[model samples]
Target: MRKRFVMLTSASAGALMLALAAPAMAAPEADTIVTFDVTAGSLDITAPAGPVDLGDGAPGSTITNQLGVVAVSDTRGGATSVWDATVYSTAFTNGALTIPVGAVSYWSGDSLPGSETGGGTFTPGQPTTDDQVPLTGTAITAIPAFSHSGGTGGSTASWNPTLVVRVPITAQLGTYTGTVTHQVA
Candidate 1:
């Protein structure tokens, strides 16, 4: 699976790059080139932070649901795989990045991240909304927790989706971001 990163900043773009180019009056430029060893890490997907009760209707029709995978499993057998995917929104502030209460579906309260469902050739790490895939983008990454076999041992494969939600920009400002977290449970 291929991986890509997208960071949207109100700044001219590439906020990090501009910060590095800015002058530091108290510092002097040196003709020395320095190199250091570093470690890299993948983006973290925290758990959905909180819940936004969609609320009830005037006649008192209540609406209560949190966004999460409906289920994770196979066609014939396997442990039900579950993912604690979180969705949140952030806004740029002179004060630093901030997190805000995100919007949920009017009905499902599911964050409007994204979803795709159906049968087709899958490209791991190739981002898609196939709701039929696993919570993780890579098929190999998502394993069947439990499995069953006939006395003769013949089990079919199963598929689900890697449900996703985009963090809303309207989210509040803070050092971190959060949103309503709920499970299909």
Candidate 2:
């Protein structure tokens, strides 16, 4: 009985040592964090859809056509405030024959970026002036054509203005080319 007891105690001690020496079976877990930031909304202006063709007409003739401009904003939450857009004719030239700025006229009566089929009128009061030419290159004369202001982000406005060109009797017979620019502030 003493021998048997001694053997049993020795086996129990060996089992305890093996349990203490072995590695833990459980795994520890931890968390990882992440973050970022976004920039404010923005405003954009697109070029006119067409070249605003006045077509072929005899000198002293008033050629009329429509010019369109589209403005947009990215502020979807309605944080955006007042927006003013102005339109101007840069210049028109037929090679050596230059058309004076005063010869071009802009009229407005459309609602918020009016269009031809949009049911807006071109009553010629927006700019309150018939002549659109600026005295100097840096001085841009605004056209009394478009009317668009104040909007939330993702808002869009269109300006379909009437462009009238008075062909000077002295205008040399040829094709004329020019550009119109839209500015937002």
Candidate 2 has its poorest 10 consecutive residues by lDDT at 115-124
lDDT of 2 at 59: 88
How would you encode candidate 2's per-residue C-alpha lDDT over 6-67 as one tens digit per residue?
Answer: 99999999999999999988758767898876556665666666766767788888777666
In the range 108-140, model 1's lDDT, one tens digit per residue, is 222223332223221222123332222322223
**Candidate 1: where is the Cα deviation over 4 Å?**
1-31, 57-185
Model 1 worst lDDT run, 10 consecutive residues: 150-159
Instruction: Please provide TM-scores, in order, for all candidate models, with all chains considered together.
Output: 0.19, 0.58
C-alpha lDDT of candidate 2 relative to the true structure: 0.58
> Cα deviation in Å at residue 165, candidate 1?
17
Model 2: residues >4 Å from true position, as ranges? 1-39, 74-80, 112-140, 144-154
Clashes found in each candidate (C-alpha, N, C closer than 3 A): 23, 4
Overall local distance difference test of candidate 1:
0.29
- The Cα local distance difference test for each model comes to 0.29, 0.58
TM-score of 1: 0.19
